[model samples]
Target: MNKFTLLNGLVVPLDRANVDTDAIIPKQFLKSIKRSGFGPNAFDEWRYLDHGEPGMDNSKRPLNPDFVLNQPRYQGAQILLARENFGCGSSREHAPWALEDYGFRVIIAPSFADIFFNNCFKNGLLPIRLAAEQVDALFKAVEAMPGYRLKVDLERQTITAPDGTVYPFEVEAFRKHCLLNGLDDIGLTLQHVGEIAAYEAKHRAAQPWLFA
Candidate 1:
């Protein structure tokens, strides 16, 4: 996981609602849990014209020119601007993995599915929920300007537009801390390595037969 203290990146508007986990990364690509190489398959069905399969040469696949992601203007976009009820349906963590791998660090939406929202934090992707009106404004702004970018300050809990207008958002303190330090669940547990080691040693001493 990477630390997400602050990010200033181009915005890409998804312009859809109720985007499910499967749509984010289709079920065919779920066999591998490598957490990477899924970027090519991100939004597979919508991004390409042909059916996508694992190990297929995505470069040769026909792209959907109408899709927002395939547009030249939004290339290399790192912030995803989306509508309400984003990330709905199945609770696959691969959704965020595909998003992160696709170069999006933050996802701004009016609402998100419960499981997807939680998975974003754990996977180092910042999913910010804002008022429906605010999201609509962002979508408009992004579309109005080419190469539109926003500055996200996690420490300040604010997203600043190019005009210096600030929209404050809320995030849980502990999740904020973990993201700031790039700590995942395993990283969090490893923080108490010494205590764990000591406890194991003490247990072994108390029950030598169990160790033997």
Candidate 2:
């Protein structure tokens, strides 16, 4: 996981609502436990036609032009502007893995699925919840200008528009701290290493018989 103190990137407008985890990353690609190598297949069905393993045959995998991600203008986009209930359905961590692999660092939506939202932090992605009206404004800007970019400052919790307008967003204190320090669940637990070691040493001395 990487620290997410701040992020500024081109916004890819995905106006659809209720985007489920399966659509983000199809189940067939879930075989790999590692987080890498899923970006190319991020939106498998939508990103490529012939609807099968992308690596199996290059000729079989044809990029879908209609898909928002397939659009050349949206290439290298690191921020996603989407509608309500984004990342809904299933608790698969692969959703965030695909998004992060696809170079999306922050996703701005009116709402998100509870599980997917929680998983974003562990994989170094920021799922920002904002008012529906604010999200619409961002969508409009990106729609009007294909490569529209937004500047996000996590420390100030503000998003600066291209024209210099700034909007504030809310994030929990603990989540903010973890992202700032690049602390995933394992990283978070390791924070108490000294205390844990001290407790183990005392316990071992008190229960030598148990150790034996």
For model 2, how does the per-residue alpha-carbon lDDT over 52-138 read when each residue is reduced to its tens digit?
663565345788899998789998999988889999998989999999988999999999999999999888899999999989888
Model 1 off-target regions past 4 Å?
Answer: 190-212
Q: In terms of TM-score, which candidate is strongest? A: 1
What CA root-mean-square deviation does each model show from the true structure?
4.1, 4.0
Q: Candidate 1, 194: how far from true, in Å?
A: 12
The C-alpha local distance difference test score for the whole of candidate 1 amounts to 0.94
**Which segments of candidate 2 are over 4 A away from where they belong?**
54-60, 190-212
- Superposition TM-score, candidate 1 onto the true structure: 0.88
lDDT of all the models against the reference? Answer: 0.94, 0.87
**Candidate 2 backbone collisions, by pair:** none
Superposed Cα deviation of residue 194, candidate 2 (Å): 10
